[model samples]
Target chain A: MSVLVFIDHSAGQIKKSSLEALCYGAALAASTGTTAEGILLGTVSQDLSELGCYGIGKIHQVASDTLNNLDARVFSTVLAEAVRSTGANIIVFSNNLSGKAIAPRLSARLKAGLVSGAIDLPQVANGFTVRKTVFSGKAFANVSIHTEIKIITLNQNAFPLTAGQGTAQVIPLDIKAAAPDVKTVSATQSSGQVPLTEAEIVVSGGRGLKGPENWGMVEELARVLGAATACSRPVADAHWRPHNEHVGQTGIAIAPNLYIAIGISGAIQHLAGVNRSKVIVVINQDPEAPFFKAADYGIVGDAFVVVPKIIEAVKQLKGVA
Target chain B: MKILVCISKTPDTTAKIAFKDNNTKFVAEGVQWIINPYDEWYALVRAIELKEKDPATILHLVCVGLPDADPVIRKALALGGDEAIRVNADSQDSYYIAAQIAAVAREGNYDLIFTGKETIDYNGASIGGMVSELLDLPFISLATKFELAGSLATVTREIEGGEQTEQVGLPLVVSCQKGMAEQRIPNMKGIMGARSRPLKVVEPVTADTLTSVVSFELPPAKAGVKLVSADNPAELVRLLHEEAKVF
Candidate 1:
């Protein structure tokens, strides 16, 4: 049995989350006495040999420009073929936007038991049991996969990355790529913005920031820290921020390394999305704020008075002008 | 056009979460349940908006669970669904739930099948994709905007650092999120009208669940917050940089 990790890339470079998935898959393969292999669907600019440092023995490249647009059906079909050709019993993907789109379809197509948002490797002593976060990160569930071939999507930053001195053998994967029924119309992209889903440090604001005009400090803090900017649902609804920047149960759920919530009253809807962050900092004036219950650190202060100082301190720490 | 909006009953957003049966089961007693926010604000509401634009379009609601989920179905109908179907089964397994929904959609011949990005209770965003694959139909997940014209449908979905707009023919599946539509509350008239609407209960399609839950556990409670006095705001920064190590 072999383990295959899907390498999701954009603009010729591999994603940080994909590297986490590779390390997780490689460790699982080692624990099971199997070799880890990787599959790259679209054309890549990075050398395939760099993947060997993550413990992958072989790298399968299906170099095609058509695969770059990220049609879920086409990707799943191509990935299913690669899995079959590589004799992989277990397939792994980072639970990002691309993985979320393709993993379920691949699971249904290959009749493989799938566990998305898995937090840890599976236990092999008995049947393969995977631990995953459920109920919007409020609870954990141990799910046992009973299928012959298993598929797992690891949550971003859930595993440690191992960099070793090695290189993998790259091979060409031959497969019949079919066009999806869905046709692309147009793409409106915001270039150079860190995606909220993949952000390590996120500085978010809410209605307490008062209005869109006062958002400069939040953005400044984010800029100084090289973090992504997010907003609460109310802020997005009131047009203080774009809908894509909203983070909550009804919005985009994110799990970053450091989540700095400024001026946002910690509502349950918002907490469900960001509670998985490794460190949480809530900056609100009210001591009774519900968000303080979940925060690793808290500050009782006014956002207008507090954010500027925080941004200045960040600049000082980074020695930026 | 016929649209079937998938809905799920979940614990209220503020419900205090706890486990029972030695942490194997969720405690449901005393907890109020509501229609999942994504389903209400995006999938079901978008379908309602479509119906309002074109009166000929029919909106139906489907849920996979026991009778306890009917109230959530009724809530959907009052908001705008014309009818409802409750598949009598436990929805803990996403694969089995998708199979049942696929069976219902096949018989109903829905032109459009819509679901939320995922259910809040399980956070398993797998049903729509699995159902689409099972029925051999095209699926789009997390569509922010869906517009239908004749036989073609335009779906705008958010991707990494961008938004992707795609066009697909009818008889496609989509899971929606925010930006699709605004939330609609049921008026008294609509609530009374929903009481008279048709709610059909159908048996589930027999299938082996690929994954079974062994147990459930609450996430470890966060440590007590170390409050930094607001008088010295820079102190918060120092804490984040030193003790927290977030930077």
Candidate 2:
């Protein structure tokens, strides 16, 4: 029984969430008394050996540009072959967009029991049970996978990335790439911005901001704090912000280290997406806003006045001009 | 064109989540069930829009649940589905649900299969991929925009940093999310028409149940909020730095 972690990367750079998956997978392999390995499909510019710091003993690379763009069918077919050749009984993935697409297809192909949005390592002592978030983070469910081969997609930020001293052996695995059925027509990349899923801190605004014209303060505050900017459902619905920047039940769910809400009243739908944040701070003029109940710290003030002040304070504290 | 749209019944977003039966089963009492917003607002609505563009298009809805899921299916019918199918089984395992839908898809031989990105309850986001694999068809997930021309379908899906538009052949499975279509309310005529729509109930196909839930637990409650006066914005910053230590 061995563990294999899928190393997800975008444009040759490894995602931060994959580093956490490596840590989780390596620890799980250690607890099970087996070797942990990584499988990288597509080309990566970074030195593969550097990833050993996350605890994997070896990495299997399938270096081909054809494997770059995510085609779930082709990726799953290759992964199923990798699982067979490596004799791996368990697989781990960071539950991001790519993982969400490929993991289940792989699970169906391999007839392996799969669990997504897992918050922690499996309880190996008792039949390989995994705890995952359910009800949009409102509740948790401990799901037991009965199949011999188990698949788990770890939630983003659920596991901390711990670096250690070691170098992983980078072995090139020879596998024929399947012809992708999906054809890529055009691709637009959102560059130079902190991706919301990986952001440690997020500054989000809502309808209370009044209009899209007032969004400069939110962006200024996020810039000073080095945080990503997010918006509520209505903000996105009204086209005040892009749908990708929307964080709510129907949008991207995040669990940042610190989530600051400005001019946003916490609807249950909005709260469901962000309740998992380690710390929540709400700034709204209405003290009766539902968001205060879920916030760690709150200030009943107009966002127009309050956000700029907080931005100045953050700048002063950080010694930024 | 025949399109099969998959939907699931979930507790209303505002419903208070609580588990009963030793935390193994969700309490069903006093809970209002709605068609998962993603399925209703995006997947089904997009299919309905396609049907509207071409009156020859046949739109069907498939769901996997017990009788209680019927009302949710009816709501989708009211929204614009021409027909519905409910597999006579209830299971939390996504693979099982996908298998049932795949069976229905296989029987119907749909030109396109649609499902939401993920249900609001489990947020597994696995069904579309699994069903595509089961049917041996191409699958695109989290599609924000979809347009079909002849046998070729153009779909734009959300990727890690941005978006990617892909073209694929028909008999495809695509999971819908925001930006695919606008949400529509059912009028009196649509509601009355939904009652006469045929909803076929079939026994579930044999599929392995690979996972089982052992227990459920709510998230730990917050200790309570600490309020700082608006005049003391700097104090709030200090508390965030020293007390929270988030940075």
Each model's DockQ score? 0.77, 0.82
Q: What lDDT tens digits, residue by residue, belong to model 2 across residues A92-197?
A: 9999988989999998999899999999889989798999999999999999999999999999999988998999999999999989999899988777778899
Tens-place lDDT per residue, model 1, B38-124, is 888999989998899999998889998899998888888888888999999985878888889999999899999998998888888
Candidate 2 TM-score on chain B: 0.98
For model 2, the superposed segments whose C-alpha errors exceed 4 Å read none
**Cα displacement (Å) at residue A163, model 2:** 1.0
Per-residue CA lDDT of model 1 for A185-208, tens digit only, reads 998877777888888999999888
CA error at residue A240 for candidate 2, angstroms: 0.9
Q: Clash pairs of candidate 2?
A: none
Tell me each candidate's TM-score.
Answer: 0.98, 0.99
TM-score between model 2 and native: 0.99
Model 1: how far is A50 from its true place, Å? Answer: 1.0
